[model samples]
Target: MADTFHDTDALVAALSDADLDRPPALVANAHITGVSVARALSAHDVPVIALDRTDSGVAPPSDAVDYAGQVTYPLDDADGFRADVERIAGALAFEPVAFACMDEWVRGFAETEPAGVRLPFSDLAGVERVLDKANLYALCEELGVPYPETYEVGETDADEIVERLAFPFVVKPAHKRKFEEAFGTNVIEVEDRGEFEDVVAEAEEYGATVLAQERVNVAVGADTSLASYVPPESADRDPLAVVGNAAVRYPEFGSSCLVERVEEPAVREHALTVLEETGYHGISESEFVYDADREEYVLLDVNTRPWKWISMPVAAGANLPMAAYADAVAEEEYEAEAATDGPRDGRWVYLPDYVRRCLTDEAFWDVLSEDDWRSLFSGEFEREGELTTGLYRPSDPAPAVRYLTGEFTDREYYCSC
Candidate 1:
């Protein structure tokens, strides 16, 4: 049973047009993503209930999760997902915002939207557009967005592929979710032809339909992403999440851990082009890396769901998750904090995780200035903006502690996989 709250009427009134009282948010999946979504919404006084496929792998969900109640549903079972969401939403008498954290969950919710439930995602076609990497790259090509030179290797002789592409290229599957789940990595970088062949063979053995792409030069430390919250009916195209400078502390070469709010016009324009061209409306992540050789940001991948470190934007003055929530429940064209032409700079970090990486990596140690350390640890880390965090929160400290716990347990997760 869902927890009884006195503010149910107010929560229901905000989430949907229905008259019945219910929780305002239905967060599916209970991993880091779900925890983040639940916490973000809760900050806005939105009541949230959590659901899960299993509890063994992820439990003791951050205290923010299960704020309303924690229910179990077979997320893999699409029919079950729709049924469960329908039942829960009906109880509250209004459609709650579906976090829809995973690709499967997003697809499920989008395909069969329970009555009165609002989901923070793109349309079905738009969801498929970004979920399939090959399709996404193809769309970018059509729209003239700069993506790395990508080659689909379909039974072509490995020697031929080796002849065309230089060494240190990446080998990844067309579909990212299944591939990552199976191998625990997004892509593998091979240094030589021999390594490439071996990697492809191993990938194929694990059901990977591989692509060989030129590795964008990141020697300048310019890994960037332009995240945005696109309202479905809004004519305004300003980005809610800007390309605030982002940095990584784990895996050495990995996803961002800390983000600074700043604008990269060319990078931002390229990503906005793709979204507008696709008529995509939702939270989307357009990844790019600075190509020092090309002197431009080269596109990498497009993510439909929230990216790691998304909370950075909220700290930097753009609360995207909330923007999407407000958009979902708005009765009309409501003005929300989507974006501004000016700069909103800030940093969001997981201090312990970063400290662990810095202490262990010689390369990391070489770049850390004394002032940077002092500022970060001394609570004076502002660089004309502000600094948020990955996990630590005084109001709700469990998620931060839980993430750092799991992050250390699987330290190499951010490293070369």
Candidate 2:
């Protein structure tokens, strides 16, 4: 039978009741999601066994924990992955719960592990559809959901691309972190044909095709998101859980800045419709741009994994990690409910960069109306804590410090920005 915990204290109490002789295995240990979940588990005195590609230098604060390093990759080599799973599983005495944080790692374990290790993903084909942007956009188009206009430029001439996509567009790699060293920007805006050609030329060094897309200027007003977890069987009904719902604001009309949370039912309905039509199960976040000209919201992009601001929703009550764990273990029939009742306005400001942008950028004033300016300065708005800040408490700063000081060599195990 599965152990149940009603609240944080009850969860901790249940952890205190666990048999430390056999601890749960946290796969992809170096990942922030793994680290956050491990820390939360540790608070409950649950024994944790961390398994990843590297040692990550820092160990769990709890003495009841152990670390095992294993090199595993997702590829066509089924034998190699199965062997690694066997080794890791044997090392932990065949731990029942294996928390998967990385996509490739998750797929590998899901494909190779025995039935005892529970994974919260659909079949391999389902994973592929969600991970690939091209596939996702194609699915969205078929479902009559709105998506940014995208054109792939593999080896085509620059003039041809410009002719097709026109100037004042965006050129981004299919995945943001593929060319981090070369481009230094996730999404690049091209004002004219000259800038577009220059950016495309630079993108070629990364061995990726440049995707020119229409620039949706939703950053001018507010960029909001609706995140949820759906089940494979119930795509037609409500989601299994609503994990996150928040809005963000930029300092300038054109600058990329911090985000916040604001409640809007219209935004939620649009996001939910897209998720359902796409058959997107697991954690999905849909971004929307409020266009003032049309007085409507336009879909920007869809993230198939946990978001950077995951902690905000946890503070607001929908703990995605816990919900995902529950769903993975089949402890309860998943149910979705609106977490945020009314329109609660809040903002998460990136203090250092937000200050700098406001001082230097003239377009900053275009983003905020007179009322927003008054509310911001008056401190009437609620501010969510930074996601990266409180992962390690003062009592335990080893993990956070190690992560910052380059002590961890397993960078791939963690989510790449």
Candidate 3:
């Protein structure tokens, strides 16, 4: 039974009930990403329980997800979150497989591996190393992976940075979440020396350690993401990889709004290398921008959890969340379906953001190739293997309705974390 519980006593009672057949999948937040994970696992007949900080009336109620209402916020109160997690875990009939969708949730679960649950991400230290861009860049350098050329803000002099690098570089935080907290966006594009210095000073005023990175002239239609799952070491199985090309993004260099499932071997290779180097075992999405000048793909960022377009992989015949869950539960070797000639040639669209960008941004039109433009107004939504939306599914229609009614109208639905 997928029951919503407002009190711990009721929640514990429901979970502890012996009649509950299978061990439920505990999802951290009920945001779009978490909802997608829940749906992915439910397709395999796994029960899903979504634990959020509060109901808040924002997240759409889904048949695929049962709410664990008003839990302690993982980022705000780590101790309380740990206690709550343990309390919930102790009531379960079997060890629940936990999936954390946000950075804070990942950190919370990693730091406190509460009893009676299976975590899918790396440990605290390993996850932190990847979350911090400075540390990630260092690791990329050590492993000979190509990332954007970067200059440290505090350590390097402002004048020297301007002198060394060309104009129109970017200023971003070493720690992305901290900066995003201070400012709404993660990056600031500096057009010249003056703007570069100004942005750096502004970031310092907010006590954020920023970095200067060369603006990679990304090739059109070359922004790619590799969604993968690395099983635990005991499973000893090959990782499952699915490559997605971001045809368009919103808010100028933000998350993918429209993606095309494609095969890019080099992008997959670089991402797997990093995951192997760190011993990261879980669902991950590694982003890359193709540098046409260098004829290479430059690694941009890595997400250790289910990404914004995670549902795309399930549509493409590679279910990452299910693969992780199976490996975590079974002792036998798990051989995932190879990334192959399935329904991989399709488009995944975050409908709200894609439509918003298309209507508002003039530059959004310039990014679209001839075929992309044709497909934009094609008005074909029902064709199988043609398109998969981020939220809308025939069987699960409430979430999409909620999104379009409330969040989409208010313009506060940028949950691309």
Per-prediction count of colliding residue pairs? 7, 4, 0
lDDT by residue (tens digit), candidate 3, 1-417: 244546655677666763546667888777788778888887777778777775532332777775455568777888888888888889877788889888778877988878778886678887877777888888899999999989898788888888887988988998776677767788888898778877877777788889999999899767998998888788787887789998888865667888888888889889899888887788888989999889999998888898778878877878899898887777434334344665456677887787788899876564445554455445334345456777766566767766667754655543544
What's the lDDT for all of these models? 0.65, 0.53, 0.76
Q: How well is each residue in 160-265 modelled by candidate 1, as lDDT tens digits?
A: 7778888889988888756676667778889998887787777777777788988877754567788777767563545575675666646576545556666688
Instruction: Output candidate 1 Cα RMSD.
Output: 5.5
Candidate 2 lDDT, 107-128, residue by residue in tens: 6765576544655555556655
Per-model TM against the reference? 0.80, 0.65, 0.86
Look at candidate 1 and give me any clashing residue pairs: 21-92, 22-92, 95-116, 244-262, 251-414, 251-415, 391-400
Candidate topping lDDT: 3
The residue pairs found clashing in candidate 2 are: 247-260, 247-261, 248-259, 248-260
